[model samples]
Target: MSEHHELILTCPKGLESLLAEEAGGLGLEDVREHTAAIVGHAALEVAYRMCLWSRLANRVLLVIGRFPVTDAESLYAQVHAVDWREHLEVAGTLAVEFSGRGSGIDNTHFGALKVKDAIVDRLRDAGGLRPGIDKLNPDLRVHLRLDRGQAVLSLDLSGHSLHQRGYRLQQGVAPLKENLAAAILLRAGWPRIAAEGGALADPMCGVGTFLVEAGMMAADMAPNLRREHWGFSGWLGHVPALWNRLLAEAQERAAIGLARPPLWLRGYEADPRLVQPARNNIERAGLSSWVRVYQGELATFEPHPDRNQRGLVICNPPYGERLGDEASLLYLYQHLGERLRQVCLGWEAGVFTGAPELGKRMGLRSHKQYAFWNGALPCKLLLFKVDAGQFVTGERQPVARDTGQATPARLSEGGQMFANRLRKNLKQLSKWSVREGVGCYRLYDADMPEYALAIDIYQDWVHVQEYAAPRTIDPAKAQTRLLDALAAIPLALEVMPEKVVVKRRERQSGKRQYERQGSEGHFLEVREGGARLLVNLTDYLDTGLFLDHRPMRRRIQREASGKRFLNLFCYTATVTVHAALGGARQTTSVDLSKTYLDWARRNLALNGYSERQSLVQADVMEWLEKDSGEYDLIFIDPPTFSNSKRMEGVFDVQRDHVRLIDLAMARLAAGGTLYFSNNFRRFALDCRLLERYTAEEISAATIDEDFRRNERIHRTWRLQAGKTR
Candidate 1:
């Protein structure tokens, strides 16, 4: 073995520059950056230092050999050419991690197996004893990268990826990896801020990744100081004396750092469930005194008054990826910008998000932007100075006078009519809502042709969905009417401007209707017919709970005592919850979307429903085909047109209702009733099927007072399995 070995430190893609800077800071020689790895030459002591301190590197590998190979036989021969006894003992375990492709080795698993065979065969030939394979905790980890006809093999000095600092035991969805988090901090210039005695905060922190990493950097603590396992611990060339010396030095430095006053490191999460995990992670990292996590909303987040120094407010907010709604997310981004401009006037900001367009909605010009990859999703790290002058002011102006009284904005004839109609509708619905005990219902549904919008009130929140204007209408006129309606909503409805969410609703086909409209995962509890449901004002095109279903839910509660209930295409299972609360014997809800199924489970749990209620994530049609159990009552309300990739086939409610109804009738107990509904306006039932089973049209009966003006909102039918009436 050479006294100085060439090392390759692999990291996530787009982080090569940070890794190179870190390697150079460590005083390594010939540091060079590649696509996703850094190459450098250093002695054994330097490699040990890197293993203990390099937070941006995923793995630190020591290059042992390189050769040219064309086929699997050549690969085996080249691998066998190395003496395995020098790296691992015959009694030890080994693991091979093969990456890259080409040169007759296309499958990574096959390549790894061949490499393993070569090493075991060489060891057996030398001493007639072969090492066992341990994938989880290997004594020696061999890495092979094959490109073109070249093969490079290295010994992984870090047993696991360096990102696994052994601090995180729990994380929220789509968590930022530790290495990536470190890279973000480096880009945010946290070291400079720390030197100036400034604080760090992540308003939307998930499990405190940023806070922990920032605390470690500020305190000058080694990243892997708490780790107990390393690849070199069991290797043949293990240097116990050198490792012990490095460990002692790190411990002394950490002790000295811990003796000093703690830095201001804080995190705020909206979800209460995530706050405890962050606290646990911080405590485990020995940063409890420095890092503090609180359950807080973004609207109320502010810098601590005790920390008077200017610092950094960095966050990785939801990117509205799976949640396709961008309109609602714009409001959140705008609010973030407002908060930064108002509260963090002198601070710096870094927002890492996959949606740069949404970042633009912040209304603040980013001075610097860096492109990075968040697990194959290209994202940008937007840096802002957070100066008041940088904020684009006058973006919003008061539509009313400063007299502190409600006054309508002066508008054109069309806009005035729109505004007047909105106020009139609010007056009418306020009385009805109070009498009906409805906290969420539609107030206005495009009452006038010029003003095309659907305004729904969820208690204090107002949701306005603007219908896309026809081509005959001028776009400018439509936009003006929309602005007028937005201005009138908050005043007429007596709600805060921030509580109003607006989305444009167009004629959607296929799966477009189900796509997300935003990433604001804000859920509010609303009451409907003695059942409490969780409805998200932002995020999806439709709220989790359908307002029009209030009547149907009440009907189910009225008829569901001691009856077995089944709900197909059960979105959020609101009806099932009502049935269960109505004392149903058992309730089963089926849907294809895991997102909705999880939501349904939460809704059930919110209402204190027990395990007697079941939620299944499956295509409703497929499940119907396989189900044999009979139910006393069933509810089926499917989308008008759905081509979800998760479904077995395209479903058009008009085309498939007959087949779907027949399938449901097969499982419908004798004398049981089946409620079938669809929102397709032009749908017409097959009269021939009515000859076999008794049927009645309940569309008019199901229309609530809020939707009485528009009876075509949804059509419902009640069918019985006995005989024709």
Candidate 2:
């Protein structure tokens, strides 16, 4: 074993090159990459040093023996022959972890059991005492691997998986493991990007894992900067001085980075729930000031305000396996592609998804395609290059309906009739808003004129209003007329060529943010089922609160009483006042935007209940890390898109919803219920993802009177603690 004199380090697959570079940087010699290992010949201290400073590797393994084995008995015999006394005391506790591929040893558990028996038996026979098994915390950790009749035994220098970087005080759903995140950064050649001052962005960043990992990589900060302990620290051969020196050296290198925002780094998630956790992770990684997490819809992500072109945007959007259907995922991808081509010019893009078919929807040719494993699922990292100059930013062309024998002119005639009606309605709306003290007005004519499309933005209820037209008509003509009038409006508002969302007009088309503003504030009111609601007419194309969740708000008024309430991503605080009036003991509202959070406070005061509510102007995800307060009633309604100047970056609802839901459930009081809603029309809830909590679909209860044309406006859900797995 001593004569072999070579060190083989185990890293999460695909990070071998990074580990090799780290070893070389530490002055180790003969660095080479293997499938999941980095092999090099170095002094024993180099192995010890790697355990302290190498952030990309999972463990620094001190290889004890490598031999061929065909059976458990042979493996046991070989394991027994090792000098156990050198690594573990007779009375010490030891744990064995085994991984095998192909070969005769098919069961990893059985292999582990055999190795444990051999180690204990050999030690007992030699010293009259056997080491104890300590699975949770052990004095010695041994890793055994059998690959196609070849066996390797090594001491696990870093225990508990180096991915536990010790900085994660909290997390959201399917969080990228630290090691995995590091591998992703390494794969992206982050060091090279950072060196060039290239920007890093995660449009669907969850808990800021990717952003934090990228920041650490760019700054050359050790991945274990926050780690308090390592498995190697307990080894009999551990050198405390060397470990301390490595850590100090890494810290000194980080200090030289100046703590400046790398060329650029940002993350966006539509769900406000992830905004807080992502901020928490970034801060934990000492990247709070360097990385930003924004809570808003992807459609609203405008990287450049005046100039429409900008930097790279990367995302790890959810594959249907753990989230929802491929069809919905495809829509998200198509929408993302449309946005990317329109807004992000002269930029590069990378999308990691398990579903390859979905990648085709992006309509961009792959510059590079990499195979990666997100846990057990094989995923593809498809890279695309976008031309900022040639990007097309416009609404999607409507799909022709299979209306048999409908003449082309027949369709055009219907469209023209609808356009004329819309022109008339807009004229009336313009006159009414001017006369009725309104700024914007809703027009029944939009992408489809045969539909009841109400436009509003007249009054203060841009805070919460809806455009409700009492008549139902064909949607195609309405949509065309709506866009025509929008094009004709003399508003001086900035319209991002890439931010326009065009759809076939589903009965439930509330996915993207459709907001437009006129120099004048105008809104339209649609009365139906005895409810008259005003819609945002000027500041945005659509009103803020989807009017469909009106029932859920009413439910809050019906059920809230003497309970503490929490509203995450509290846009206009419509639900905050609802809970407060329902008699909540105290309400804490969270959102990234001070503008919206302040609006929520005003809404509460407007309803005569100000003393009972508190507004927190921070990312809810980050705030949850330091917040342990539980609430009896919680409302988590996040935006479809927002680019808050106060936040880190942008957000996408479909990508961040699962984790957001889980975290909200974590803070619920015993017997507490949380109302989580989203307007992403194509959103499909992953029941398996929320197996730890019981969820009931309250979509029916959330729909209000004015929003009956589309039933899926908002989804209300109740969660309780339970074992999902």
Candidate 3:
């Protein structure tokens, strides 16, 4: 049993090299790294020592036999060939775990059953009692892995994953496994820092995982010393005397390490709910004196250590899964950067995040980046050396009371890339805006697939709408790229963060487009086509004025000279105001909602034409059927879908567009034209309507230079009475 035998230490992916190094340090011979595992040769006592000490391994296995396996029968025969009596008693309870797939053993359950049956039949055939299966508490745990028609059967030395550590009883949301946390600390050079007795802090620590792990490492405590049971305890190969000697030595070393002065290890969590849980976990880990946690906000998270003390700042901050969520996470990362710059000078920062691009929002350049896997998702650890000499956007200068010179913040590489694109778009569109005297235009329309966002400029304020990403793309990745673009917005436009408004854009079925996104009734006035429009950029999903139809509004302005104008489905009546600007004699606008009719009233009042314009708050379809009104010029722009309670039936633009256009045409006078438009991406003009009316498709001319990239922004057509003009 004391003879050197092959042992394997399995770890999380990306930590194989680290595990091999640790195995060599643990006195294992011929240590080598493999895929998600480390292979070495060690005596039974050395394997026992590793089971009690190794921090970065999930499991430790002792190889017993390796034999050729072709099918379930061959797998059973090979497993039965092993000397079962030498490992466990014939009546002992056992569990079989199988991994990999090949040679007719397609699944783990079937493979495990074959191994179990083989062991049971072999023991019984030897004139001994049959062993029973005990998955939870087994006297022997057998692990089998099939690779290239070979089965490597082994006895599990560590029953459960070594990462259990038996310290963290309660955890916060998205908790990092104990082994992964140790690997992160090692990568961050925490052992060297701990030996020097430097302070450690986690600003966004949840349940104090890093603090507890760092505390144990600094105190020289064995990770699995407190584990009462192990896979070798019930095996015949276990040497109790050797294990006892190693345990005593570990206990003595822990006592010696704990006698020294405690290092400053502190954690701050933004959630008040997690503060108590973090404290409990710290106390359970016997680190109450060395580690502590407090309820704190990221913006005000300040860790005060002793003088002349510099340490590592490590944290795994909260992340999001949706594109619009970047608005807040972007600021979260920025706040961390601000804190690092303001207070953590001469310190090292290790930021672990699943959304790697969000790491760019911190503005601090990382000297080194290490890739690690957090389960199935890949994450990055950005190592930054906080110093005065490493700023690109410069430091925050003091603001004067009169001048109001706000602090200038730096953009990260990704943020800078997006900012440059925004600047390029603005530079090209500025000439068009100056020539047309247009105050609102689309600055960007998802020019970069990485940054799937539409950025619009309302004179000085910026309006950004995020289109939901596809289902196939990872939400975490989409959100990180989104953070990059959002972090660049204010920097690119040289505007305040408050001036940038963000909203999500999707297919609106009913009155959802007009639904209030916020209660703040703030309004901003922007100009278009020589007309001043009132836009509530903060109060709704839409900013009241549709910038994509800028040229179409101008077309209406030029075509409505001395003609009676009628606007159907008139949302906010911005086009009606343009019609009134073109010397229209009288104009009537119809809508279903009283809120919009009131808004239309305010729009007309803003233009000083209350008498000539009329705002009716009736359902356009129902009202058009009842009215006997005729106009020289008319416009119809309907919603893609509407199921409002007041409306008699649901309205779908694709299904009921033909009926809608014919009703609006009834109100058009002879020789007058009806201009129709809708923003549906898949909108197709009805051939039935085309057969009845002389229609001229003008979709291309309606879209201006700013919206030319997204030709599907909206469709427009000019229609007149009769099949032949």
Identify the candidate with maximal TM-score. Answer: 3
Candidate 2 — worst ten consecutive residues by lDDT sum? 403-412
Off-target runs (Cα >4 Å) in candidate 3 are 125-129, 305-307, 393-408, 411-453, 456-463, 466-485, 491-676, 680-712, 716-725
lDDT of each: 0.85, 0.65, 0.86
Off by over 4 Å in 2: 1-4, 12-34, 53-55, 68-73, 101-107, 125-128, 258-263, 304-310, 322-324, 388-725
Tens digit per residue, CA lDDT, model 1, 605-675: 98998688988888888899999989999999999878877876798888898999999999999879999
Clashes of each: 5, 71, 0
Cα lDDT of model 2 by residue, 221-249, tens digit: 77777777667766777667877777788
Judging by TM-score, tell me the better candidate of 1 and 2. 1
- Which pairs clash (backbone N, Cα, C closer than 3 Å) in model 3? none
Could you tell me the lDDT of residue 396 within candidate 3? 38
Tens digits of per-residue lDDT, candidate 3, 1-725, equal: 44999999999999998888888888899988888998999888789989999999999999998898888999999898888989988889999999999998899999999999999988884555698889987999999999989889999999988999887888898999999999899999999988877889999899989998899999998888788889998998888899999999999988887788998888999789999999998887777878989887766666665536888999997766542355656667776787787778788889999877767767688889999998998999899888867644467334334733335365557778999999999899999889989888898998988788889888888888988898888987876677667878877888866577777887666889887777677778777777878998767778889888888889999999999999998999999999999999999999998888888888888888899798898888899899998899999988888878788888989999998898888888999999999988888998888789999989999989898789889999999999844
Model 2 alpha-carbon miss at residue 558, Å: 41
CA shift at 681, candidate 1, in angstroms?
5.3
**Candidate achieving higher TM-score, 2 or 3:** 3
Q: How close is candidate 1 to the true structure, as a TM-score?
A: 0.68
Q: TM-score-based ranking, best first?
A: 3, 1, 2
Note each model's CA RMSD in angstroms. 8.9, 18.5, 8.2
